[model samples]
Target: MCASPVKKNEPDNRKGQAGGDSGPASRSRTDRRNSQAAKPKREHVKKSARDAALSVLTGVEEAGSYSNLKLNQILREADLPRPDAALATEIVYGTIQRRNTIDYYLAKLVTKGLGKLQPWVRSLLRMSLYQLLYLERVPDHAVVSEAVNIAKRRGHQGISGMVNGVLRSAIRQRAELTLPQGMTDAERISLEHSHPEWLVRRWIKQYGAEACERICKANNEPPHVSIRANARRQHQDALLEQLRLGGFDAEPSALSPAGIVVSSGGNMALTPGFGQGDYSIQDESSMLVAEALQPEAGMTVLDCCAAPGGKTAHIAEKMDDTGTVWACDLHPHKKRLIDEQAQRLGLKSVRTLVKDARELAGEFEPASFDRILLDAPCSGFGVIRRKPDLKWGKREEDIAGIAAVQQSILEAVHGLLKPGGVLVYSTCTIERTENEDAVARFLEAHPEFVFDPIPTTGWPESAPLEQAASGMISIMPDRYGTDGFFIARIRRLA
Candidate 1:
């Protein structure tokens, strides 16, 4: 649920001091000032849920803030009741996620066209239309009434009338709404699933039409909150029991052995045993990265692009906290995140460093480690269900630029791996150019490295290991019900 924006009533606590006089005249003057100050506070209107949703929509649209980050900040500050917050969140994310489809409806209804309307007005209509078309629980009249009231507060009477008329007309014409005529299958899928046309076309070329549609549909759904039990502190069964005893609706993940799926937990940090390093919040797909590496008790490993150190800590945990795992990221601020995660998981083997993966060869010796995890930075198209805004935030051209960076990091880290050392290259993306193509190119250029299939013995039986013979695996969100990820394991030949 999206949280609504709140109009803060800043109470004027500045009171005039009665200077050395307890007389009625002096006290009356102070009281008058206090009364005047209180008047302004009452005039401050508490923003309605629609108003809050509008603020967040405009913030993401105009100011270019990430929707999830912006929404969380606003919700924390507004402190709206749970129901209002839920409505606000629903409107914000639902409208944004379905922007293309909503705009299609608006284009048919608005006489002036959607582009002609003011940005806030357009957002208002989109939010209203989203509620009408998608949210079955909310009544159309109530959504229309809220939009009109928000418009009246934010604009003139004519604007209010327009919003009211447009929504009412849309409600009347709901059955007639359809996508623009004469669209190709790709174009139709793009609008129907509310994804960019270019992205849809690219996916179609790679995964075919049916699979691409499923992927797009899955991206629109809410993601599960999956966590990995820290093997160093507690077993998976122990962590599951602890969470269930604490009243969390928890279940073991069928995708990863160490994973737990919590349907109704408030916050992971607030959960019992979190302070005692019982588990780490991670995706079921992401947990496989560490498992594929198969780190031993005394091995030296490098997580080249580790941030927030989820994989690095997992590696340390698998090693029974007895190995050196150098976790490095380019951003200096992220170093603390890795350190904090290591401290939370009670793993003493992880050491955080703020060095770019592309420049790792300059700081470390050649063939320095037994295992290296290169979780390269990518376009993040695979995790769109968790962060819907990513679909709009990314551009098709950005893929090539990111792929170049991934290749460079791969080349740089290739020399750092010890002969016969295992290197698992992974990304939270399903794009072939960034995953299969990149690995293919790396293998062609570096013949000394050979494909190392991810062993199935310790892996979850359900994990797709059929492709492991090629030293790579791809998990589709729709088929797996997890974040889409690509992992390729390679080994340096002695």
Candidate 2:
């Protein structure tokens, strides 16, 4: 979710530097100084929240950048105040989540097709429209006026005038801009929920019309900022108490015993306990993976495809940092992320490695670990609530490609587990091919492995629901207001 900001070379506007040096380099210093005054320098104007949001939207559409990563980079570079930063974050995410519906209304308002407009101009319209339509706190006049100012600054008067007219028309015609009646169910769900049409159809076929509609609707809602308590350092109740005492609207998560859902007191990562590694920011659904694995004290485990080390840390914490957990990722830098998380959480049992899980069987001793977690690469359909860009960025074809890779890794790691050792397969995706079907196939090809029911001894009464198989659990976003996740615990019966 981070990268170093790239610096572009500034164009020198001095005499000789202008238009490839017109022999002005030979001029005297006085002449060069006089030439500099010929053209006025551009003033350094700071970006408003709207401007920042527009830039983020444009970056996502034009350069195929990840929304969260681009927003973080821009916010860091701009160094805006907390309120403005919060506003920008809201505008960016809301605009993305409702892009289809906004664009629909804009198509009716804009004489020029939405696609024909410049990327930033289109983003400006979408961002402005989102605020005008959804942001009740901000006045309509303020939204219109600010959007026009941004247009004028970034583009010509013609563009600004077009933006002004379009926004004004949209404001006047807002009530009439509802989705037309008589559309198909998939189309209605797609437009109403701002999801891609094909996805809606696929989900409807998989989960039925009612459930698909619920899933799509839930994807547009804001993701809960849940954190897992570092049980090794602080108990769940104690951590929740500390957070509440510090003015955080903290409550225990119904999903996981160690999970705490913080409604307010923004950016829990910046809190003192997070810095001290008392908890790690994670989704409640994902916190279930380590629990599914049931990592015990003095056991050796493998965390395949571990990065940013959230789940690995959870596993180590479960073991009281007593067991040796080998956390492996394909990239060296990713390994560093796990190592850093381990250090911050004071988990001494975690050993980091830059190795691919797909190649683990060849390079490592066979039947070496007590437990293995194949948190495989996936299409990430289940996480659209957090990363809305994945909706527009991914295509239907990508699912099969990702599933093939998952199959390869699953094949590689099965041999690394000792007799009666457990292997937990998990992904932040809702695709059946990569979830239930993949596990079903793995079980079919390898008869030694069997899918066991997930341990639900302490789970609430409402936790279990219908599934394609008994061992796997596919928790939809709408089910428990958690990220869409699939977890299956498989064991090799030696």
Listing every candidate in turn, what is its Cα RMSD in Å to the true structure after a full C-alpha superposition? Answer: 10.2, 9.8
Off by over 4 Å in 2: 1-43, 465-469
TM-score, cand. 2:
0.90
Q: State which candidate has the highest lDDT.
A: 2
- Which pairs of residues collide in candidate 1? 1-89, 2-88, 2-89, 2-90, 5-52
lDDT to native, each model: 0.80, 0.81
> Model 1: runs farther than 4 Å from truth?
1-43, 180-182
How do the predictions measure up, each by TM-score? Answer: 0.88, 0.90
By TM-score, the best candidate is 2
TM-score of 1: 0.88
Cα deviation of 320 in candidate 2 (Å)? 1.2
